[model samples]
Target: MGRSRSRPVRLVASDIDGTLLGDDAAAARFRSTWEALAEGERPLLIYNSARSSEDILSLVDANLLPAPDYVIGGVGTMMTEGRMRTRMEAFIEELGPALDPAAIAAIIGSIEGAILQVAADQNPHKASWHLHDAEQERIHDIAARLRSAGLDVKLIYSSRRDIDILPRTGGKGSALAWICRELAVDLDEVVVAGDTGNDLEMFEMPLVRGVVVANALAELCRVVAQDRRHYLARASHADGVIEGLRHLGVVR
Candidate 1:
């Protein structure tokens, strides 16, 4: 369903890469739009990204992006709030057990085309890799091997090259939903924005409005097209996010 104009936006959670960081002009426009909102009318801003919380914070510190009220980092395996970097313990607790990186390594090591990403890209709950010219069947086989070994994990492939293995309960959508529940914000009051395959989960969430940036990947765009709750922006990057917010009536 389309976002209702009657409901005031309470939160805006967005992916970082192509969604917010691509164009300097668009990023500036988005910042201006956000800063222009009146205090009481402003919604809680959330930066949901595949980067680690420290990485996200660095950008905020450098003023490349506006400071966020909350950050869902490490592709949802990690969550932190504000500049003080307070951990969301409840969200961590719900993630159950840390993923076994060693076991994951053993399983994926046999796959010739897979290359593990840098240490900075991995966390206790996430194992990231790069797939080089691999087929979809290879990706599926890798996932199957992990599951057969009794690991409760979810594999996310994005930009046709990156692979992230997260706990079954962790993802952008789940992290955002958990945050909304903790903050007592209705799903309808939230607008999630993204531009790639990894961001698809957040857009699939029922009752939450979605912003599919003009530069979004085809896989994501295909899904967004079928959903009435999502807005397909005319502009790219952060400019597209601003356009979508206007269309959803979150911004004037």
Candidate 2:
């Protein structure tokens, strides 16, 4: 098991989709719970998701969730301070040069079963796709071919169809670590919760004790349920996050 932090909990890092905002009822419950937390006890909040900063702002504007303290977007390829355009440009600069999107599209284009996702969904460090075939074997073969070609990207398949090719250095777990370093937050004091494949990276790190929500994809549970520091909860969605917080004694 992962070692518990010696210090008291101070922050919560979470995924947006599936994990925190699965259905309407769940989303509403999470909001209420967040509001209920004592002001003095409120932990720092960070939202890490596959969404772009623009979309994340739309959610904030729509009052779907309170403004997050920081946002890790584009499947960990981007980070921004609020919705400022300059912040977005800085994130792009920090990511530096990456494999061209056109080359990635070209490769996936040749794969009959693969279809590109929306333009906004794509990022310098991530190439998003959807699989028509959805066959595990076929996906594996394609991934192997990409490896053989030395393209050096990590493929993450989730919910049977969504596939994302991320740079070797890009992923939720790594992004969390980076954020921790930037914010001077102790790894031991952070709690991260999620519900699917993109979340798998968060669970693998010893520094991040992950809460796998009840609504999580079966494939995700099959792979991570037994790992150290990963808590499997029966409560679904936002309620599950509450359950995880309680289990860790991070929130009342």
Candidate 3:
């Protein structure tokens, strides 16, 4: 959906869980490939995940993942950058008012099977939950209930288990777009990777190429299949990401 693929990649953003994790060896390979690139050729790296900024940083500290230039965390409601992990104030300000988790909890209190995620997963702008085995109708009903109650939010159901309620304007795609605008990077020059439904938003961005790891959830695969700009790697996790990057000519 973006311009053309002729532009050299200037940014490589990926989800942390199923897209870039799971295989230590593959993670090492990705790190080596990324580090091997000449400094001027290296793209701005970003890790976009449903995880908290601190949670993602811990992985970097442990060497499980390469450090990122920026982190789009909490399902895109929060962002932080650099070693000190400074909060992205402009992004936060653009997200408008934060949604109250308590208010959202009360609204969905009576919805059967809608269990709130742990406090660690909850954030000021994201009211997350675990709705495993719940019917799509039921999940939509919960979202409907909240909207009917006057809350302006978006419902992202991913991994067939997670339900993240974020501000209508928030999502990985929107968050990445904000970064591209701020950094003056063209959307066509940004490549994204992920493996779940929540990661769908990033893939949906117009003109942005994407990699859907082989281990990705079916919900994500079905959508990516329709877009030829996105590559579905045969390998899983980090290896899949590397495979897609090579296929897209973003890496050797």
Query: Which candidate number would show the highest lDDT if scored against the true structure?
Result: 1
Of 1 and 3, which scores higher on lDDT?
Answer: 1
Candidate 2 regions off by >4 Å?
1-6, 82-91
Residue-wise C-alpha lDDT for candidate 1, range 1-252, written one tens digit per residue = 344564778999999999998999899888888888886778999999999998998988887888899999999999998767998888999888998999999988778888999999999889999986566787898889999999889998888888899999999998998999999999988899999989998988878888999999887998788887888988999999999898887788
Give one digit per residue, the lDDT tens place, for model 3 in 57-105. 9999998887789999999988999467999899999999989777788
Tens digits of per-residue lDDT for model 2 on 1-252? Answer: 333454666778889888888777878877777878886888778788888867876787888876677788878787766534235455455555786677677677788877889988886688899985377888787788778777878787877888888877677887777878777888878888888778788777676677899989887898888776778888898889878877777666
- Those runs of model 3 whose alpha carbons end farther than 4 Å from true positions after fitting are 1-5
When 2 and 3 are scored with lDDT, the better candidate is 3
On TM-score, the leading prediction is 1
Higher-TM-score candidate of 1 and 3: 1
- TM-score of candidate 3 to 2 decimals: 0.95
lDDT of 3: 0.88
Taken over the whole model, the C-alpha lDDT of each candidate is 0.89, 0.78, 0.88
Model 3: lowest-lDDT 10 consecutive positions = 1-10
**TM-scores of all models?**
0.95, 0.88, 0.95
* Model 1 whole-model lDDT (C-alpha atoms): 0.89
Which consecutive 10 residues in model 2 have the weakest lDDT in total?
Answer: 82-91
Q: Between the candidate structures 2 and 3, which one is better when assessed by TM-score?
A: 3
